[model samples]
Target: MLPKFPMSRQCPYHPPAGYAALKKEGPLARVRLYDGRTAWAVTGYAETRQLLVDPRLSSDRSRPDFPVLVPRMAAAKLVALVGMDPPEHDVQRRMLIPSFTVKRVNSLRPAIRRIVVERIEALLDGGRREADLVPEFALPVPSTVICELLGVPYGDHEFFEEQTRRMLMATSTADEAAAAGGALNRYFDELIETKLAEPGEGLLDELIVDRLGPGELTRLELASIAMFLLVAGHETTANMIGLSVLTLLEHPEQLARLRADERVAAGAVEELLRFLSVADELQRVAAADIEIGGQVIRAGDAVYLPNAAANRAPEVFPEPDTLDVGRGTRHHLAFGYGIHQCIGQNLARAELEIALYELAVRLPGLRLAEPVEQLGTKPGGSVQGILRLPVVW
Candidate 1:
């Protein structure tokens, strides 16, 4: 029998040894990481890949057997993606896919670069000699880039940034996170109203005002979609920005090489993304009893695919733990796999590439201003990232 792990544990991210332990233990094992809930953690690369693609795994939280990882209210706020089974998830996903395709994202490159350059300039002019890169550079650049892409007013950027931070803080009280989420929904509602009045050329406006008729996306659903874009797009890229810089700074030789060879920078970003595997884990409920990798999971059971653990699997990646930029690690699950793969991946790549390329070129002498251990990661960011990256160029 597998060992029983309980849900009364601390944050999953705090357990650094858990991945190593899981690897030693077995492919499929029970975990108690959620708030007193029993869940399965699947570690083998092939197993995780298979599970992610399988229709038997469900993302719906409304089911009677929903496996919750947080307080009810907070969990609801986090899993707001149209949780319907395949066809519905397929429809909503398809609707948003066009906005994040390679071509569409590439089209946004010039605008993204402009945003990066503008932010860097402002940082430099506004006393960037010593600045918290997360707030001053990493956070806002993507927040605004996504905002502009979605047609949210630049003025509301402040509101989105603040509430997003509150919602992600691991220590946030249930009420506090819920309040932040509500504030975001209210802001999006008003923004939706404005867009309906005078539809802007932005994507959100286009989706709401153009795609949907009178009552298509209910207020909650529309707000949820908007919230998804804002938080996911914002936190993921921001963390990459902060973490990539820190990684490059720590390995001066790699940083120097990247600076010397612009061609290699893109590869460096991919490798760093693979190495960091910023997203912690993914949650799914077993739609029905299914067997995989020689294990049986019953219906209503929660399964966690630790993409981080899979990324480090020796079978898929040789010397998986090492951060080698030239290894050609293209299939990393950093953006996830199969149907639920991140829709904003192309946009994220554009943003990371631009940020790394520009920062290397602009801040040639940049280095971490504090001890490595002193730097902190955001406590509760669904998309894991640095809390503050202090640097001086």
Candidate 2:
């Protein structure tokens, strides 16, 4: 029997139990997806890296055979950089790359630090013995930063958060996801019009005055890019923040280590990113015939690259399941590989380092308010994260 795609994880920190056996089977194997579609699931680290940069593979979601994780995702149009193919993808990605470059992100470090510190202070000021870290701290830091950077009103965070949640839920119906996407598109449309009228000192305004004003990009495409940044910039990082804290609390020794030395904090972030592998699956399609792992991926064949499994591959990292903060995880596929890798990774690293560092220093007594098993996980989606993390200090 073909194993089902997105096999459920028995533990939040580990890949689905079936993944170990799957990796043992081979580098690649066919799996059945939600809509009764069969696709190739790549589990080997080497193969994942090879295909990630292969020109024969396409990230274009408009392809009929593109591996859609959910019916809702299938119904949605592909207007963002994440779903575009070369030439178009290159052009679009280049336009936004300047804002995410290391130099630019580093320049924002002071602001990000201020946001993290403010959020931590707010949590402390609540005067409560216990608080849900997800909302009080984890979500706010990145959300506020992204809003300021994009010139979007942070007051509308609740609305966009809800819409993004619906759009990404694997079980959401086509209509539900479409409605959520529509809401976000409309919001961006209005925001773009506002920016056009009176420029602000945000990334969106820069794009409008520079790129859009020069007719370098269409209004629709600009809005779509802004929407992508707003969603991707905050959602993944927020989830990572919450999940990272929980993981550290569970591993007290590592937590102590991180607390003891700030120098090792950067390495700890990479290790956690590797171990968690939050975005479990990266979807793609075969644009042309390609031979990999002694198998032919025919044109139009759907492909599912489960990065979580690849990150845990023994060949890449000895004792892959173990979380060692000192482990060299620079080559890990958590942010993915090749040209389509996360553009916001630099900013993500900075945010995580600052957040974790501040959490350690400010709340040295931090502990889970409830049992680890009692914590809820997001039901089904590309991103893997905790529903809520209650903690006490």
Candidate 3:
């Protein structure tokens, strides 16, 4: 029997144990899927990068034969810009690029810092010794930042957050996930309707005034894109913050280094991104027969590129299991490679760097309330993170 695709990590800090074994087999190893079908898992760093940028691989989720790793993935509405190929993907990404450019992210640094400080303060109120960082700090900080960024009413965070949660839950049935996705789309639909009457200063309003109103993009497309931004703009960052804190706490010496020198923050965050690699495999279907890494992936074959495995490839990162904050890792696939790579990479980088530095410095006395093995995680979705990070100082 072939190794199954979508293996879960035995430790939140590591990729799935099966991934290492798969890598041992070859770069393009055959894997079994949940639906009794077979797919190719690109486990080697070089092959993963090669496939990620190969134009022969299609990201469109609309194809009838598209691979469904989980039930939730069947709901194509959740894959706006990511589920696109060239021309459409290029156009949509260019439109959203202005909002996430380096200059724009630098402008948001102060606001991100303020948000992190406020969350830290909340965790420290009345000299409290402990709080579940996921709810108290990790989740809310990015959720609030993204809410303000997208012009969504912050008061309704719980609604959309829950919907996004259900939508991304791997345990969700196809119908259940569709419902959750529909709720978010409808919410964005109505929100766009509201903005149509009176615009705001956020990204959604900019699209409404420029793209939506002019019919350059349709209501459905705009709403789908908005939902994507709302869910992605925050969820991934929130998870990264949670995982980074846990990683640093486990490595006290590294934690001390991060706290002592603010200069190391950028490099440390990049290494953390490389170390954590919270995202799931980047999925695509072969558009044509393509030969790479001595294997031929035929047209319509499902290809899974697990970045977690690639990030830890011993060939690329010597001592890959060890987390070195000063490695200055610039080539890791924490953000997917090629033209379809993460659009908000700049914003996400800023958020992680600020949050980790602030939390380490503000709570230098921080320690895990429980053993790392005992902590529960919300892993195996489109993203991976702890469900709660109980900590004390």
**What TM-score, to 2 decimals, does candidate 1 have?**
0.91
Worst 10-residue lDDT window for candidate 1 reads: 6-15
Instruction: Compose the digit string of candidate 3's lDDT tens values, residues 1-393.
Output: 998778887788888888878887788899988888899999889888888888999988877778899877777533788988888889899889999999999999999999999989988889899998888888899899998888999999999889988887778888888898889889999998988888788999999988987889999999999999998988889889999999999999889989999989999988988888998788989889999878899998989998998998888899999988998878999989999889999999999889999999999899999998888766564688887789999
Clashing pairs in 2: none
Candidate 2, 242-292: lDDT as tens digits: 999999999999999899999988999999999999887888899899898
Candidate 3 Cα misplacement greater than 4 A, ranges: none
Tell me the number of clashing residue pairs for each predicted model: 2, 0, 0
In model 1, where do residues sit more than 4 Å from their true spots?
Answer: 1-15, 72-84, 126-128, 214-216
lDDT of each: 0.75, 0.88, 0.88
Model 1: per-residue Cα lDDT over 40-143, one tens digit each: 88888889888988999988767767665554234352344535567767867877888888999888889999999988898789655877898898888898
Candidate 2: global Cα-lDDT? Answer: 0.88
Q: Model 3 TM-score?
A: 0.98
Using Cα atoms with residue i matched to residue i, what is each candidate's TM-score against the true structure? Answer: 0.91, 0.98, 0.98
State, as a TM-score between 0 and 1, how close model 2 is to the true structure: 0.98
